[model samples]
Every structure is written in structure tokens, then in C-alpha cells.
Target: MRRRTLIRGAAAVVLVPAGLAAATSAAASPRQKSAQADDLVGVDVSNYQVGFDYARAANEGLDFVVAKAGGCQLSEGPYTSDSYAGHVDGARAAGLRVGHYFLTGDFLSPREAADYFVDNLHDYRSGDVLALDVEVLDDSTRLWNDAEVSTWFNRVRERVGAYVPWFYISTSALRSADWSRTIASGARLWAASWGANDGSYPGPPDLGGSYPDWAAHQYSSMGSVAGTSPIDLDLARPWAFDVSGPTDPPGGLPKTSAEQDGVPGPTMWKRTQNWLRIQSGYTGPIDGVPGPNTYAALQRNMAGNWGYTGPIDGNPGPMTWSAVQRLAAQHGYTGPIDGVMGPNSWRGFSRFINADAWD
Candidate 1:
């Protein structure tokens, strides 16, 4: 059984640098042509901005608001944001998309911190954005290791059924850390980097070879929104926060005796490989070996519709199987979206891969 802990106080430590405030006077505008007209504009807030006018902000054209849920501080141990509840409620009432972020620290175990974060996130809905803020500001020498980061995401995923958590990190920190394991866990990237420190959307950062794509880019920390001054401004993709159902319908063969067996064999893999080659640009041979290239192609194919946002490293984990389950949902698989795959999940998958064209 999971242990629940009480949250202490309304204030928590915010790790944003003091130098960001200098750019507060700059006009909040998109300075780059890369800023697409369809990109959603939003702000992230914490206890520092109290009594924020969410209705006014929404009226002023802000699309979403990501509020600080809570965090485990070095000095205070664990605490909840005093304004978390208010921000969520106000944003929802004003018809703004809502998201919650937890500032992570090295004070507690990753599992413990994740549990505490979920416990304090009372207003989380099925599709609300959930992010783990990873940044160290003081003289603290301890930084979260890659394994710990993956653990935190896995723990959160275990508790929160279908929603995949986002990994929040600055450009410098992201470049320094080896987050290959975290990437394999299907944690979406929410990159924070303020270029020129001006209140303008400077477009997404170069990522410095960290990941392939970013779900959201925090362009400026000095953005002047309607209700809040010098707030963290962001441009997010619609698919990243899209809560609608899957994009494509299942186009698979009818269930056969082999699919009913619910066991994958060389024949099944060959069919899957052929499907991957035809659809997902897989150059791998149809040798019936489910190797890294095969799985990597599968990951790429499932990314847009089935929530497989992890690296295409070819090593399948819960995230990969969960995507399979989502695809399976259309093929008569009525199981939970938990990453655990069983006979039912396999049967549904077999039905899809056993199409005659692939054969």
C-alpha cells in the first residue's frame, strides 16, 4: 500500500534565477518567424504570484496555465504550493487549459517525491499536463541522476493511469545530463531556455543534441501577461496536450486462430516487420527477428497517435507496450491502459499485425 503524507504550508522554494526580472520591462511579442500562428501561448506560476487573475489572462488570449503543485525542498523537506489549488480552479473556471508541475529536489527518494507530488495535486484531471521540474539553483552539490529521474517518471506513471509525465529542464542542464534512460521511459520534454532574456518568443532552442523534439518551449521568463508580470511564457504544440481520442482508426485483419493463441512467434514478427517496412519507413530485413531497428520503427509509427514519445532506441519498455495497448483498444482489447501486457493485449496486437498485405 502507498503511504500518504500531509502537506505543510502554502509557500515553496522557487528556483528561477534573479537575473530574469531584469527583462520584465520588455514587450511580450514573438520576435522570430518560427513562432507558428497555431502555437498555444501560456504561463507558468507559483506561490510568488498570488491572487493571479486567471479570467483576465484568459480574456487576454492566454491558452493555458501551468501552476506549481508542490516540491520537496532541501531545507523544508516536503511542502505544497499555497496557491496551487486556487490557480487550478481559477484557470478551469476561466476556460483555460490547466497543468501542474512539481519542483523536484534530492531531499527524498524519487518514488517518495513522486508520491508526495501526486498526493498534493488534488485538481488533476485525466488530460491535465503533469510535469517534473528538474533544476538546481543553490550551492547544493546533489543533482538527480538519470536513474532517479526515470524512477520518478515510472512511479508517477504507475499512479496516473494514461497520462505520460513531462520532463522539465533547462537547456544547459539538459545538455549536461545523460538522460537516455529517462527518454526511454516515455517522458516528454518541456525545455526551458530564455534566449536574449527578452519578453519575446525566440523559438525553440537548438536542444544541443539532447532529444529529437520538444513538446513545449519556454521562450521567455520575463513575459508580461494580463494578470501576471514577468511570468514564464511558453509555446506548446497541440498534439502534446491533445486529450482527444486516437488520431487513426485500426486497419487490421480479422482475428484468427493465431491471434487467438495470444503468443508472438517468428511468423508474427515477420508480418510486423513487413508492416513496419511499408508504413513506418523501416529498412530492416523481414527475418522474423524483433531487433532494435524493428522496435525503433514501431516507436516512430506510434508516437503521434498512441503516446510513444520515448527515444527510438529500439529497447521496448512499459511505454512501448502501453502504446500497443492503446492501438489494441481499437481491435477489441478492453483492458486497462496500464503498461503491463497480457494475453488479451497480445491477441489485439496480433490482429493488427496479421493483415494480409503485410503477409
Candidate 2:
């Protein structure tokens, strides 16, 4: 639904290092120099970018690609981008780290829009970056509120386990709304600000103190890549495309008061309640009681990845424990995933939830 208004001359092809980061420029200022040295070169494409040659772009030193997944269009309502799958597949095939973004519109509620976005995502893997693009609504007078935007991010995080999604917005449009809640939701900034529009890499954007630092900067929409001309170019930090697994808590997993008897007690439940409160949308008191509220939030968080497709009824059935085991497998649970919770499973789950962050 968004279109580039300006088309500049072909960008000067800048060679990137074998690694993700690029070399610094001596002619630039101090802030610009730092951005150039640490930022990775990447491009974002939608259906408008036709027949994009991903391999050629990668050969030209591009490190990543963020393709448009789906969003609500002003005319068509909620719709998925037809080219989303091809862009993701081609970018991955070309050895480029891939990401996906969903454009938000005024048609649907933020929760519904986020659910649609996650449902329409193609070939999603852990560590793949996700983003919510919010810009000015040309056709509608209503702008997205802070709580609405936060709801979108929180809903997406509920489905996808770890990692925060990037929040994309231009400097002017961001000023039009209060984003305190969205910021508190842990969504990183993908600041968009084009200065001069001369196909030159702009320095660190002036976010007007809205964010401490940006995860990615969309500096030029008219920049040229090897295989694609007049494309949206971005400079992103290494954390923007980090594919490493979730970072473990400091000093490793803490000891839980639960006995090694395979049954979770009050202490473990309390910690889990706190985790669900922070990560998922659990608003219940942390009374260490494993009630329906606790299990319901856990089910929402596991629905996307752990294969818990049932309702959030707060009832932990065999399917619920099975999904919990699937999650525990990543944290050192080697036992059979037979929907059975045993001592080993408890230990592994404790390894995951027994973090100081939760406590």
C-alpha cells in the first residue's frame, strides 16, 4: 500500500565486508563513521519490486532482505502480499538473512491485524526478524493509538516466543501519536528518515528522543542495488539480523523451590506467572496458583511454535504438556515428548523459566 515518491539516480555500488558489517568511511562525520562501520547493508521489497534477482544482490554485498508479508490495504481490506513467499525463498536461497514486515492500516483492530499477519507468514523460523510498519493513513483520518500499536506487538510476541519485533515509522508520522506503551512493549525502532535523497548513506537519524537507538535506518528509498534499481536501502546493526538462539540468563538457571519430584509447586508457579505476565498477556495476580489464567496465557504463547492449537481454556491436557515438552527440548529436555511431565521435563522447563528476569 506504500509507494516510493522519489526515484534518484543509481546508487554508487559500495562493497561490503565478508562479514555482515561494512567498512567505515573516513570522509564522514563521527556519528556517520560509526554507522557505516557497524551497519549491515540490506533492502526491503514488496510486490512493487518485480523479478528481483536476490543472488545478484547478495553477490553485490547485500547481507539481508526484509520482504513484505501482508497487511490491511485501504481498498482491499486485509490481504496478504502475493510476492511474499518468493521474496523470502529467494533471499534465503541466496544466503541472505531474511525478515518480514506487515503494514498496519485503520481497517482492522490491532489484535486482529496482528493475528492475520502471523497467520499469513510464510516459512517462519526462529531468529527471523519481524516488523510492524505504521505510516500515515492517507485515506482515513484516524491514526493508530499507542495502546493499539502495543496490542499488535504484544499479540505477535505471544505467538512467536522470544525476540522483539521492530517498529517501523517515519519521523514525522511517529510524532503524530503517543507511543509510550508501544515502546514499553519492547519493540525496537526501525527509523525512516531520508535526508537530501541523493543516494548517499545518511548519518544516524534524529529520532527526536523517541528512541535511544535504532535497530535499522531506512536511509534511502531511491537507492540502487545490483539486481534492483531504486530500492529501499537500510543500514542495520548486527543485532537486527542476529540468528543465534535466545540468550541465557546471567549465571545460568536459578534453583527452584520445587522438589525434583516432577510436579511444579508454588515457587515454580509464581515464577511462571511472572513470566507469563511479562511475556504474554497474563494479568492475574502472582499468587503461585496454577489456575486457568496461567495456563491460558501459556497456551497463547505456545500456540504458534509448540503446536498447541486448542483453545486457551486454562486446562492443561496431554496436548498442552506435549507442547511444553517441545519447548523444553530446546533447553535440554532429551526425554520422549509423549505428553508426559516427569522430573526431567520439570528440570528442563525450570531451566527455561527459572530466570532472574522472571523473578
Deviation (Å) of 210 in candidate 2: 1.3
Q: What lDDT does candidate 2 reach at residue 348?
A: 79
* Cα misplacement distance, residue 198 of candidate 1 (Å): 1.1
In model 2, which runs have C-alpha deviations exceeding 4 angstroms? 4-36, 137-140, 242-359
Listed in order, each prediction's TM-score against the native is 0.64, 0.59
lDDT of 1: 0.70
**lDDT tens digits, residue span 251-355, model 2:** 433457543555687778877776665545566777788889999878855653466667768998888998888777877889998888988888778776664
Please write out the lDDT profile of model 1 over residues 49-119, one tens digit for every residue.
67888877877778888888877754557777777899899999999988998876757789999899888
Per-candidate clashes come to 1, 0
